[model samples]
Target: MRVGIIGFAGSGKTTIFNALAGIGGDVAPGKAGRINLREVQVPDARIDKLSLMYQPKKTIYASIQLADLPGQAPGSGGGFDANSIAKMREMDLLVIVARAFDNPYINAPIDPASEIGGMLAELLLADYTVVEKKVMRLRKEAAKGTERDLFEQLFATLEAEQWLSTLELSEQSLELLTGFRLLTLKPVLVVLNTPEDKADHDSASELIEPLSSFEAPIFALSAKLEAEIAELDPEEQLAFLAEIGIQGTARDRFIRAAYKSLDLISFFTVGEDEVRAWTVQRGANAQTSAGKIHTDLSKRFIRAEHMTCADLIELGSEAKVKEAGKFSLKGKEYITQDGDILHIRAS
Candidate 1:
C-alpha cells in the first residue's frame, strides 16, 4: 500500500510527510523526481495481542509505504506538471495537504474550500486531457464501441468538474482501463496544514466543513507540532499530547484514515516464531491475499485454516476456538475478513 503526499506550492506537504515518516532531517526539495519513500509499521492492537499470546520471537505489524513527493515549486504558478502528476498516479492512496496556516510564500491564509476545490479541479482537468487525447487518437469508425462510450462518459464527468471517483465502474470495465491511471479515480485523504495553535484535530474539523461534499477523508494538523511529537519517545509523546489536550498522534489517525478511505483491511498470520499483520484490499479472497506474504504461497496454495482474532482472544485459546467450532477450513475462493488469522496449507 503506497501513499503519495501532494499539494500546491507552499502547502507544507513535505513537512507533514516528514512528521508522519518520523525521520531525522528535513527532506530537501527543488529537485525533480526526488521522493523520500519509507515503509512504516502500522500499529495494530490485534497484532500486539497475538504477539503476547504466541510469544513470537519477532513480531511485525502491517506497514504502508509513504512517499514525500516534492510539492509544486514556489512561483511555479500552482498545480503539478505532467511529470509530477504521473508520480502521484502510482500511489494506492493520496494525501493532499492544503495550506491553512500563514506562510511567507503565500500572501494570505488558504481557505479550505478554495484549496480543496482548486486541487480537485487540477486532477479533473488532467484526467480530462487524457480522455480527450485518447479520443483524438481514435479513428471516427473506431469511436463507436463500448470503449468509446466509456471515454465519452468520463469526458462528461470531467467536463462537469466532478471526480471520476464518483462513478462506480464495474470490475471488468475497470480492468479494461488498467492501462490508464486516472488521477480523479484514486482514493484521497485531505490534510489541512494548520498552525500550532490549531493543533487539536477537533477544532480543525470546522475548517474542513466546506469540504464535506468531497468523498476524501479530511483532517487538519500542525506538521511542526506533529514532527516535534514524532521525535519524542512513545511514552513521552502520549504525555505531551495529553499536556496539549490532544487525544493521539496524527500518524496513527492518518494511517487509519487512509485505510478507511479505501475500505482496506488486515489479516494476520501468527505463530511462536512470528506474529505478523498483512494488508489486502477489502473482499480479497484467501488465495489472492496469500500472495501478499509470498507469491510462491499463492501458486502452491491449497486450503487455509482460518479463525477470527476476536474469536481466539474471546474463546481464550485456539484449542477452545476449534472445540467451539469457531475455527474452520477455507477454500481459495473464500473471502478473507478483517482481523482473520490465516494459516495456509500449501502443496
Candidate 2:
C-alpha cells in the first residue's frame, strides 16, 4: 500500500511524515523540497502476541509506503507541476495535512476548513483535467467507428467525470469509482495540526462537519509533539502520552487509519523460523494473497490450514489449536480475514 502526504504550505505535513517514517526530511519553514519516501511497519497488536508465542528468528510486519510531496501552492513555484501530480496519482491513499495550529511563523495562516476544501478542489480539478484530455482524444477515435466495448468504456469514463463534477455522490457511487484511481476518489485522511496542549479539543467539531459527507476520517495531532515523543524510549513515550491523555501514538493511529482507508486487510504466515504479516485488499482470496509471498507458493495449488491468531493465543500453541479443532482446511478460494494465520500445505 502507498499513501501520499499533501497540504498547503506549513501544514506540518513533512513533520507528520518524519514522525511516521523516521525520515529527517527538510521541515524548514516555507522551504519546499523533493518528495521523500518511507516504508512504515504496519502496527498490529496480534503481531506482538505472535512474537511472544513463537519467538521467531525473524519477525516481519506488512509495510505501507508513504510519499511526502511538497504542498500545493497555487500561483507560486509552478502551481501543481504536472510531474508531481502524476506521481501522486499512483498513491493508494492520501493523507492531507491541514493547518489548524496557532503558530506565527507558519508558511500559511491557519484556516483548517479552507485548507481542506482547497485541497479537495485541487484534486478534483486535477482529475477532471486528466479525464477530459483523455476523453477528448478517445472521442476523435470513436468517430472512426471503434469497437463497441472500447467505445462503451470511454463513454463510461466520460460519464464518470461528468457525474463527479456536478453531483455530490453518495458513499456507494464513490465506492464504484475505486478502481479508476481518480484523484478525487481516493480515500483521504485529514490530519489536523493542532496545538500540543489542545490535542483533543472539541472546538474543531464544527470544522470537521463538512468532511462527514465525504466519508473521510479526520484525525488531530500535534505533529511537532509527536515527532518529539517518537524520539523518546518506548516506556517514556507511553508515560508521556498518558500524562497528555493521548491513548496512543499518533504515528500508530495514523498508520492504522491509512491501512484501513485503503480497504486492505492483513493475514499472517507463522513459524519459529519466521513469522510474517502480508497485506491484501479486502475480499482477496487465498490463492491471490499467496502470490504476494512467492509465485511458487501460489502456483503449487494445495489446501491451507487456517486459524485465527486469537485462537492460537488462547490455545497456547499451534498444537493445541489443532487439538481443539480450531484449525480448519481452507481451499484456494477461501477469503482471508484480517487476523488469519495460515499454514499452507502445497504439493
Candidate 3:
C-alpha cells in the first residue's frame, strides 16, 4: 500500500517521514515539487516470532510505500498543483500532518483544527474541480449513461462541500470512479504534530474538538521527538520511548492506524526459505488473497490449508496443530482472517 504524507508548509511532515522511514535529514521544504518516496517494512511482532521459530533465510514484513510530497502553504487559495495532485492520486491513503507544535517562527498559536480544516478544504476543492469538469464534459457529450450519472452524483456531493467517501456509492458507481481518482474519496488520517515539550499535554483534546465530527481518525505525536528517537540505537530507543511513556515508536503507531483506516490485514506464508507477511484488504476471500501472492495460485486454487499465528505459537509446531485437528481447510470463497498462515493448494 502507498500513503502520501501531506500538510501545509512548516507542519513537520518531512520530519514525520524521516522518523517513519528511519532516515535523517534537514527536513527542509522541497523545491521543484519533488516527492521523497520510501518503502518501509511494516513492523509485525508476529513476523518476529515466526522468524525465531522457523529461522527463515528471508523474513519479510509487509511494507507501505510512503510519499512525502512538497508542502503547500496554508490558505494558499490556489488548489493543489497538477504534479502534486497527480502524485496524491496514486496513493492508497493520505496522512494529513496538522501543525499543533508551538513554533517561535510561526506567529499563529497552535491550532490543529484550523490546519486540518484547511487541508480538508483543499482536498474537497480539488475533487470538486475534477468532478465539475467531468460533469461538464459529459453534459457536452449528451451522455446520460451510468458514467454520467455517477459523475453527477459526485458533483452534487462535492457541491454540498461533503466528501465522496461519506456517500454510499454503489459497486457500479465505485467502478465508474476508478478512472477519476477523486481526492475526497480516499481515506484520510489526520496527524497532529505536537510540540516535543507538550507531547503528553491535554491541550490536544481542545485543539481537536472542532474536528470531532470528522469521520477520519486523528492521532497526536511529536514528530521532532520521533525523529530524535530514530537516531538512537534499538535498546536506547526502547528506553527513550519508555521514558516518555510511549509503548512503541511513531512508525508502529502510524502503521497500525493506517492498517485500521484502510481495512487491511496480513496473512503469512512460512517456510525455512522464507517467512513473509502478505497484506490484503480485510474481508478478502481466499482466492482473492491468493492473487496477492501470485496470479497462478488464484487461477489454480483448490483449497487453502490455514491456521492462525496464535494457534501455531500455542501448538508449538504445525504437526502438533494438525494432530490436534486445529488446522482448517478453507474453500476459495472463505474469508481469510488476520494473521492466518495460508498454504495454497494449487495445480
> Best lDDT goes to which candidate?
3
Residue 46 displacement (Å), model 2: 0.8
Q: Write the per-residue lDDT of candidate 2 for residues 62-104, one digit (tens) a residue.
A: 9999899878662243457777787778898888888777756
Q: What's model 1's TM-score? A: 0.92
Give the clash count for each candidate.
Answer: 0, 0, 0
Query: lDDT score of model 1?
Result: 0.83
Candidate 1 runs further than 4 Å off: 24-33, 73-78, 139-141
Tens digits of per-residue lDDT for model 1, 237-303: 9999999998898888888888888788999998989999999999999999899999988999999
Q: Compare candidates 1 and 2 on TM-score and give the better one.
A: 1
Model 3's number of clashes is 0
- TM-score for each of the candidates: 0.92, 0.87, 0.95
The list of candidate 2 runs beyond 4 A from truth reads 23-26, 74-78, 144-181, 201-207, 210-214
- Stretches off by above 4 angstroms in model 3 are 29-32, 107-109, 200-203
List model 3 lDDT by residue over 132-244, tens digit each: 98899999999997888888888898899989998999987888788888888899998988877656435456656677877788887889888888889989999998997
